[model samples]
Target: MHFTSVQCVQGENFLFLVNNADDESSFTYEEKSGKGPRSWGEINPHWQACKNGTLQSPIDLLDQRVQVLSHLGRLNRDYKPAPATVKNRGHDITVMWKGEAGEIKINGTEYKLLQCHWHSPSEHTINGTRYELELHLVHKCSQGNLAVVSIVYKYGRPDRMLSKVRRQICGIDEQLFHHIKSVDPKQDKELGIVNPGDIKFGSSRKYYRYLGSLTVPPCTEGVIWTIVQKVRTVSKEQVRALREAVHDGFEANARPIQPLDGRPVYQYP
Candidate 1:
């Protein structure tokens, strides 16, 4: 069973906090991942200290009436994208996944869906339990406001998107990863967007809404988080595709949850 506890604490990501904000605390950058030279979300030795430390995000689930704002009605004013493009975010890791998609509208803002990546052992740990996988739907507004739709995976069935994602990358498993010399997330297959463009949205009315940081460091806060209570199921074959992707490490892609600092996590009214 996988449970995700998300908090909507409004503010910029913590990386900005440690750098720009004046009120710094041990919560800012004392963790392991914070000290490493890793890129925005990639793993590094720094994560070890972070896992042991407390100050993290996706805090406890709080019961309250969160204001349900209308989806942004901003349309893609100008959009022309490839099926997939690789982003060398400077962490020695290149994201060769999906591309900017002209779909999924919300709150007056028409956002473009970028690449979707997988996480093993899940990212959001609810109460104290974790899940098998998590899919991050990365979206960007024309103005540059970043919004992420986080979907947790439950194994036993194959999810179509997950299956397609696995076929894109080469080595997604540990034994094969450790057993082999090297694996390239960009080589040996497709490097493009692979999710359905016409999947219906607003299919569920229940969602946990919050303002939280990126689960991974530099643990930025102030991101608008919407964890849908209703999860879509995928085929078991789909789950294998993702499970076989990383196949290395102890499924350590998820970041530690930060302290709520008295923030409110609300369910849609």
Candidate 2:
């Protein structure tokens, strides 16, 4: 199915649209395959943006190029506990909120929380240095635009939110293996009530903001990206658990850093 032709109804489940737009089994992280990231646009007509989009994401935040702007302000969020589920999507582990999980405000526009997923070795790098993990808090406004808040983690103390759902993450891997061995469809494990606030944003209110596209295929553009300035800590085991949870060939799922393309990167004070 072509993603560009998919009609998005206001307040509809954006995650559902994303999951169905492209088949996960059709492409892979391995570069040797013809269906890898570099060839995503050719694999399907709907994903031409993957190769042609000028505002692609996962760019390296070079310190020499950022413009510090205090007026950009702190990230304003009003999150709450919501019924959620954890799923191993073969490519990554995602925690999906099944109810109103609250929203984040940017430039006076409110974007409702949708879902968050993890990527190993961090998709966005700082001054060319990649971290151990990256967490993307996905949100969508009523107008169907997306705004993502990304938190990159280094190796040290365990992450608070990941620690909370460690057991569930392990179970997801087990279920995924079972499903792969059988003919049953994939399933999401109920994570009960999960509070988005538990995922800390660190002490610094500073962040780098820019416009970019989805790192995954379809590679939709115009996503508002807010990357936290502070690099938090996570245990080695935590990173290992996440990497092992996904199927093979996706263990290192971070996309190669895209060119800045002369886009201005703003840093908030």
Top-scoring candidate (TM-score): 2
Model 2: per-residue Cα lDDT over 143-231, one tens digit each: 78788899999999888888777544454544233332232127887778889999999877789988887888888877788999889
- The alpha-carbon lDDT assigned to residue 186 of candidate 1 equals 33
What's the number of clashes in each of the models?
46, 0
Per-candidate Cα lDDT values, in order, are: 0.44, 0.79
Instruction: Show model 1 residue runs off by greater than 4 Å.
Output: 1-56, 62-82, 85-99, 126-129, 167-189, 198-202, 233-244
Q: Per-residue lDDT for 146-265 in model 1, tens only? A: 556666656555565434333454435433222212334434334555444422223555666556655554454445565655455655444443344442323254544556555555
| Candidate 2: segments with Cα more than 4 A from true spot | 1-21, 168-185
- Estimated TM-score per prediction? 0.58, 0.87
